[model samples]
Target: MTSEKGIAAVEFALALMGLLLFFAIFIQFFIFFAANERATFAGFAASRVFSVQGIGPAVETSEKIDSDSIMTFETNRVAVARQIPMPSGINNFLTQGRGFSIEIEIPTFNELDYKNRLEQDDNDF
Candidate 1:
């Protein structure tokens, strides 16, 4: 009589599970990378607008860029909120002074284009 060994079956199952786990982690990393790229793009766009024409221009630029991209941008003056000590006389001016900051938030890859490719139906078409 011949007996079949279960070692091969167990090994194959463990290997398959490991492969699935690896793919899951890889997908997560890819999504994070894509989100980071989009966020950086939005920040750059906001900064460029602010540098060229100031905060008022930044608002319009952000609106325009937001329309074209898959991220949201917000501009604000946060210098006042910082814990840095203000100079005696300059404190009053600093209170009214407007420093600019931009926040960019991007959605996940699943929201933009799943399956690892951009949609051909975009305006580029």
Candidate 2:
């Protein structure tokens, strides 16, 4: 004497649980996509400022840009963008006097004998 009413209720509960799981996953994916997009846009915006004003002034501008002043995503996006200059390798090349300099070897062919691979790629190729 089993009726189908209990079976229908059980099936409905299972389907509802599955729907909730799917919604959770979708929301998580949406958050990740938004974060990645923000990071990318921040990188480009920071790069533009760097290209225009170089590293020191760009850092200063970022500090001056007042995080609370703007409610837009771009303001919050590049909050830590100024740290790129001091990233280990380039620290030695930057002096404290507000200018950045990197020794990009402008080499002719065979200039460093066997060690100018980077210059060859840039200048020759």
Candidate 3:
């Protein structure tokens, strides 16, 4: 019947809309996760530079990551902080400035101390 066909078309349209909305949400979440991964990698890379080169070079490298991220490093400690930007409406209702922070400690190396520890362990065995 004509009425039956109309009802079926309406239901299919509604279902299609729902499916599209779900797909959009999935894509948004994927982008968010990718951004997070990049931020984390940047933090670790900056920390490595700080440990190997020094604070100045590390700070310079971190500055290239993005405007939303912050990096700081001292003699033996490095820290990176990042903020995730969400849609303006969602940000207003939810907690503002959602972000992550990472800190790494650079180990100090002392050849004499290491050698002494090794000898002590050898004597104990």
Relative to the true structure, candidate 3 reaches a TM of 0.65
TM accuracy, model 2: 0.45
The deviation in Å at residue 24 for candidate 1 is: 0.7
Give the Cα error of residue 71 in candidate 2, in Å: 20
Candidate 1 local accuracy as lDDT? 0.47
TM-score of every prediction relative to native: 0.43, 0.45, 0.65
On lDDT, the stronger of 1 and 3 is: 3
Per TM-score, the best of the predicted structures is 3
lDDT (Cα, 0-100) at 38 in candidate 2: 44
Which stretches of model 1 miss by more than 4 angstroms?
1-5, 53-125
Give per-candidate clash totals: 0, 0, 0
Give Cα-based local distance difference scores for all models. 0.47, 0.44, 0.65
Q: Arrange candidates by lDDT, descending.
A: 3, 1, 2
lDDT of 1 by residue, 51-83 (tens): 456666655655564433332333432111112
Q: Select the stronger candidate by TM-score from 1 and 2.
A: 2
For model 3, how does the per-residue alpha-carbon lDDT over 12-33 read when each residue is reduced to its tens digit? 9999999997987687577667
Give every collision pair in model 3.
none
| Cα RMSD (angstroms) for every candidate in the order listed | 19.6, 15.6, 4.4
